[model samples]
Target chain A: MPTKTVAGVTVDVNDEGFFTDPSQWTEEMAPELAREEGIDSLTDPHWTVIRFMRKEQAEKGTGPTVRGLGKTSGVTVKELYQLFPKGPAKIAARVSGIPKPRGCI
Target chain B: MNSQIGEQAATAGQPDPIEKVSVIISQGSLEGVYPGLIMANGARAEGIEANLFFTFFGLDVIHAKRHEHIKVASVGNPGMHMATWLGGVPGMSSVMTHMMQKQIAELDIPSIPEFVEMISDTGAGMYACKASVDLFKMEKSDLIDQVQDIITVGEFYDIAAGGHIIFT
Candidate 1:
């Protein structure tokens, strides 16, 4: 229930900074969220992944797994790490304004 | 400046040892293959290097002909519900395998072959045990394309040096 402001938009975020309710997300907030996730810039490849993840979450009711993202997101796994280090799926989901994907562990 | 001091402090520590994880898969069942695959994928997602060494019965997990057909172990599996006697019934293993596969599918998990490909594509090294290959009379041709090599235990250990080793 904690709220944080990103890109001048107020949204619900968990302690881990993952969005609690994805409906409040906006594309404009992605850069700010990405910065907090240790990414200073959103390259086209990053946006490609973020947009793909948002679309998948909206349609599938859950975000894609890291493997699924690597295989289908038009981004290779090696590049995924280069884009979102440490934890690509979790960080990408957080930046994309989606819930933490299930089966990530 | 505070940021300068923080940067100095960060660099003062010894460089972090490369994060490497070696996962050994010793069972061939559907349940068996997933743990190693999931862990390796998770590790790579975190920017860590991961290697999977498949040995013994685990060879089936990477076998081109068998990887896609791994079945759940029903008999003697305490996790399975129903009497042990019922587990021995003919066709029960297939029933259990189907049920488990359906449950995993409902969770949207990819099939075994898909998982192997995904993990491999993610840069995790997939190695088949040389001893198992010789014992089972399997050639390199018998393995899925994702397998990086058929390696000896000694070779696996050499690759695993300075890395965390997990047996599943």
Candidate 2:
């Protein structure tokens, strides 16, 4: 288990940079993680996706698939790419401090 | 450092092509189609262009009337965890197909038709192999509307050029 220092706090992360213990995630770390994912800033729509993903993970024990997120997160898939770039689900999950969404290959 | 600069200069004239993924679906079983569909959709989710080519038994997946009828192949499927002889029993395949469908439904996964529609809606290209179509005597009308066209293997390769090609 590798550890990363985000926001002056050490947290475990997997080889792919996904948080090993999602419970250790903090709101303050979101922006740092977002920047690391290549997004310069988090807009309201971005927060909407992050918050929706966190809520889904808390209830479902895993983040929603990209299709499910697009359908339910009030953000369309096209817009999700605009916000998160190359890999929305993985990037969003990392920024939200959750495991990669199920069925994301 | 000189080598690095040379390498950069060698490639500076042209913009990089958009990342693309080409998936070949060769089997028509429930298990086979889902992986290809999932992968294509995954590529789209990753903002990569994706194309799915159906050939051989995979043509069943694009058949307007048969796409929905794909069944799980339990007979001789080592993953079924049963006696090898039992797998050959009649009706077992259907039972296994139903079981798999139920499991997928429980996971909130869509059916094959619906999954195809969803992937197509994502701008993923769907194609059928011309060789398979000719061998099976299938016409363009036999395929789902989502299919862009029936293309030869050479054309498929040409279109899939400059991208990762995955066979499932």
Candidate 3:
């Protein structure tokens, strides 16, 4: 129910800053959202993860967990941490305009 | 009510999120080993630094030859929903372990060996107990390559300082 302005576009988000309705997200809004997580810019590898996350969430109705990302995202687990910093799966889901993944691992 | 309090505190920035965890696995049964592994993996998933210390029978979980073959305890486990005597029957342990493995696989949970590799790749530390290693007459080479070292309880405490310590 909470809305925030990112990239001059208003989007609904939860208390944790994850998008509540992913449909409202646009590619242009990602850089600003990534900044909120202390990432100054989105590089090629970051885009790779973000794109993979969006596709997975769109197909599965939820984002993948870290293990799933490591297994299938074409990105290794160590690389994910280096790209997304703290909490790669959760952060990637946020930047990808998906709700937080519900899996524990 | 507790959750509400936590939310309020979070909003006020009164407490920090958990930044680290140390999990001690002291048992070898399939069920016994999972809780610690799951917790350690979950911590790393959340970007929390995690360490797993395997001691006593828990070393079976890291043994080069036995790690992949650890079995669920069929006998004397009331949670199995069967008679204790029936569980003691020959082949019961294997059957139950197979069934449990299938169920875990269905849930997308990794097997013990694969899970360990995944966790290790996430930068989570894995160590074996020095006392337990000596008791079992195992050299460092006997453990899987992922284990960082054989360490004493004091060393584990040193690493676990300023974090939650969980014994399973």
Candidate 4:
């Protein structure tokens, strides 16, 4: 999956067909792929982190590195990855309700 | 039965007849809790009788002591970088919960404790699911004092069968 736009903001969704704008993602569509799979619902940190990833994607046309996001947030890369063991791309992709970003494994 | 109320005018050529609605919320996650409570409170605001059934994990919302401790899950969510974006969101899980609680507070939305209080105040009926209680090993002592009954699914159905059924 590539970047999709909603309200003019392009977000990076991944290959699982996960990252699209929420407007394009229906309630039924979201839960079918991403409910409680090693993860529960999107929490406050999720809102923060995913929004950060989208902002990065918007500015750069690609998702930022976990290290980059972590560095910016002033937390260690280990902590970032620890927080998102599934990786930021997959997590952000799911919450944005878009397809998996291309090249996500 | 908002729909039934809507239909009353069509059938009887009168204003909607004292329409009522009931909702049952089964999930207990922080995110899942408020929609049910808000809907019930909103219904009450409109003077529609709303009943809420708390079951399974949703029990946390109505718990006397656990009410304030309800937390949001951020550890392994999709878009896991929420902390990076928010720049230090505070009391997010508890805070958001409290903000919602505050809405109920200001609007006088009831706490699990207060909800029981207002059920009497507003004449709304509240109950706990007996099977869930047993499954969770909870007793009446575990619940707030206001629960009208510890009911079986069938018991919930007895009261909820005719009205609108909502599972949040």
Q: What are the candidates' individual DockQ scores?
A: 0.42, 0.32, 0.73, 0.01
B1-168: candidate 2 lDDT, tens digit per residue: 999999889989866755999999999888878999888888887678899999999999989999889998877678889887887788988888999999988887788998887788677899999999999999999999999999999999998998999999
Ranking by lDDT: 3, 2, 1, 4
lDDT at A17, model 4? 45
Candidate 4 lDDT over residue span B32-89, tens digit each: 6766766665454334666778898887766777766665554344443455335235
- Residue-wise C-alpha lDDT for candidate 3, range B1-168, written one tens digit per residue: 999988987789656789999999999999999989999988887879999999999999999999988999998898998898999999999999999999999899999999988888888899999999999999999999999999998999998999999999
Candidate 2 docking band? acceptable
Q: Residue A71 in model 1: shift from native, Å?
A: 6.7
- What's each prediction's TM-score? 0.75, 0.72, 0.93, 0.46
Q: After superposition, how far is residue B156 of candidate 3 from its true place, in Å?
A: 0.6
Q: In DockQ, how does model 3 score against the reference complex?
A: 0.73
Q: Name the top lDDT candidate.
A: 3
Compute the interface RMSD for candidate 4: 20.8
Worst 10 residues of 4 chain A by lDDT: A96-105
Q: Model 3, which residues run further than 4 Å from truth?
A: B1-14
Chain A TM-score, each candidate: 0.92, 0.95, 0.96, 0.54
| Candidate 4 Cα outliers beyond 4 Å, as residue runs | A1-105, B1-18, B76-116
- In angstroms, give how far residue B74 of model 4 lies from its true place: 2.5
